[model samples]
Target: MTEKISIESNVMDERRTSGELEIKIFNQSDKTRTALKKLALWWGLSLISVLLPVVHFVLVPLFFFLGFFFAWKGFKSEGQVLDGKTTCPHCGNNIKVGKGELNWPVTEICQSCARVVRMEKKEA
Candidate 1:
């Protein structure tokens, strides 16, 4: 038996209740990873600056601070669903996608109103 728990957020409550199946792969995320990669690249080079302890004790602490700061910023920047807005065919109202990739243009339907709308195209 599958259970759904609603997670409250700024926009909507997202949940899914279904029997587990292998074939139905759902929404995939890529933003957090991209942010981490970007953060790693920047910190990898900047870390050397903090390693130098000559006449400065601030280097070590600064290094740690900047390192963590950058990492946090990176992870926070991505993974947020972009503005996935479209018209709800059933309600004739505005709709924005909070998650998921628009793979099949015609297949994506709104859960709230059973409204079918074209998938908002995005580059992977």
Candidate 2:
């Protein structure tokens, strides 16, 4: 007989340390879009900040703070890789697959076994 583990306890522990949580990326394309948006926002804010300094000292600080805040958020946030590791079915060897690159329910030649191995993304 096999023991079944509780999903709540095994998957999500309350006392787990920070940075241990799984970073989930729903769509890989969204990552590129988000980066471009942040770039545009930072550029606009920087131009505004530069112009504000000529107007008044008080406004200069406010614009500078806002510009720095957006820059910090844009560059500092950690990103998750869409790729994951799995075991090859044919030769029992480990393989890495990327969600953005491969289509689900597809097969590929395994390096170890030299056999066609099927890969599918499973939902949790």
Candidate 3:
């Protein structure tokens, strides 16, 4: 059986002293993520509108409004980035990742082991 270690978010920062790399990941819940995606879509459309001068005036404002709406929805939604860490199963080293890269626990590339590993939240 493989030993499992729990990493507490309270104790660790972006960088660890034990040769762990700092990474940024997403930590929002499904609803929040969906809302954020809406915001992103708004922004994308707004950007694209800028390229089309004929529709810039109308599309830009429209997209901005939609983006704000999504932002508000995401703000009201529950769930946030969980504070925790996981061990690199391949190299047996501690790995730190940002909350942005996580969503219901996902697989990520480990810097130390140079292998893909599933990163999950550790209950404190």
Candidate 4:
């Protein structure tokens, strides 16, 4: 009879840092959309913040948080080359595959809830 042996290993990619969570960021189209959106939002919010004193106190913070959220989000929204598949985060409807052209934030909007869903990175 032949002897058999079993072995176990805890191998994982060393490139990934232990403390930091991995994330994927913008593509060419996504990067463009993000830049424009942030610019528009910043300018619009600046106007409101300057035009109204009382409201500015409240709105400025609101927009600041919003801006931060979008900026952070923009960095993670880069997606893989769209295949013929995507799903609506809101409605659960399947999205048809297509190429992006600087309209990622809007173009990828879920038709159901009209909310933006996560996009896969080319690496992910």
Candidate 5:
């Protein structure tokens, strides 16, 4: 499911700003579904690569192995960031953070002023 969380952003200049972030946490069934989808996509690519002449020798095997690897990774994933809006500490403009795998201390570039912003969960 989705959760709203408080976050803090740090600018290169040492300025800190507070904001909110939205994240998606996958349940067991969701993880399984994601893993299956990833596996199907990669395996499908491998099947398509079989139509290629000499490239199939390399691509087919690569995609076949990569499918299992990616599926395992997808199954292990706990959550992902959906999106977030935070103030750019440097430019004082609103910055939009894109989706990404769930990880602490997410780093993003400010679109308004092109400054780097480091984001982390806000401590109580």
Candidate 6:
């Protein structure tokens, strides 16, 4: 499901800001699909590595194992941050939160002030 949500941003200097964001929460099927895609990508790389001369011995096994590992990781994902708009608490400049895996208390850098910004879902 997709929703417009409120988030809070903070800096180490005790600066805080609030912003609105759009996020997508993945369902079971979505997680399964993501897992499959990850598996396919890594496995494909493993297959291609077989054509390499000496590296095939290492790369093939590495990529093959990584496929299962990444698939398991993708299956555990809950949601993703699509995009968001926020203001830098330090420089008071607008910052755009780009697409990424949804992890609580996401940290970003302020382009204007070069300060680290921490973001999290606003508590109800």
TM-score for all predictions?
A: 0.29, 0.30, 0.40, 0.38, 0.82, 0.89
Tens digit of per-residue lDDT, candidate 4, span 14-75: 22111111222356776667756875686578667867867887787777677767665655
Best by the lDDT measure: 5
lDDT of each: 0.42, 0.43, 0.56, 0.47, 0.89, 0.88
Q: Report each candidate's C-alpha RMSD, comma-separated, in the order given.
A: 12.7, 15.4, 10.4, 14.9, 2.2, 1.5
Q: Which residue pairs clash in candidate 3?
A: 23-98, 25-98, 25-99, 25-100, 25-101, 26-99, 26-100, 26-101, 26-102, 27-99
List the candidate 5 regions with Cα displacement exceeding 4 Å. Answer: none
Candidate 3 lDDT, 5-121, residue by residue in tens: 343222222432222223333245655676778789899999989999688999999999989897776655434443335666556666655544324334446778676565444
In terms of lDDT, model 2 sits at 0.43
| Minimal lDDT window, size 10, model 4 | 13-22
Residue-level lDDT of model 1, residues 70-111, one tens digit each, is 666545442333234444445545554555322333234666
- Candidate 3 residue 35 Cα shift, in angstroms, is 1.1
Candidate 4's C-alpha runs over 4 A off are 1-36, 80-124
Worst 10 residues of 1 by lDDT: 16-25
| lDDT tens digits, residue span 1-124, model 5 | 7999999999856689998889999999988998999999999999999999999999999999999998998888777889998998888899888998776677888888887898889998
- Expressed as tens digits, the lDDT of each residue in 79-118 for candidate 6 is 8889898899888889999998777777778999998888
TM-score of 5: 0.82
Q: Identify the runs in model 2 with alpha carbons over 4 angstroms from their true place.
A: 1-81, 98-102
Candidate 2 vs candidate 6, TM-score winner: 6
Top-TM-score candidate index: 6
Lowest summed lDDT over 10 consecutive residues: which window, candidate 6? 100-109
**lDDT-better candidate, 4 vs 6:** 6
Off by over 4 Å in 3: 1-37, 40-78, 120-124
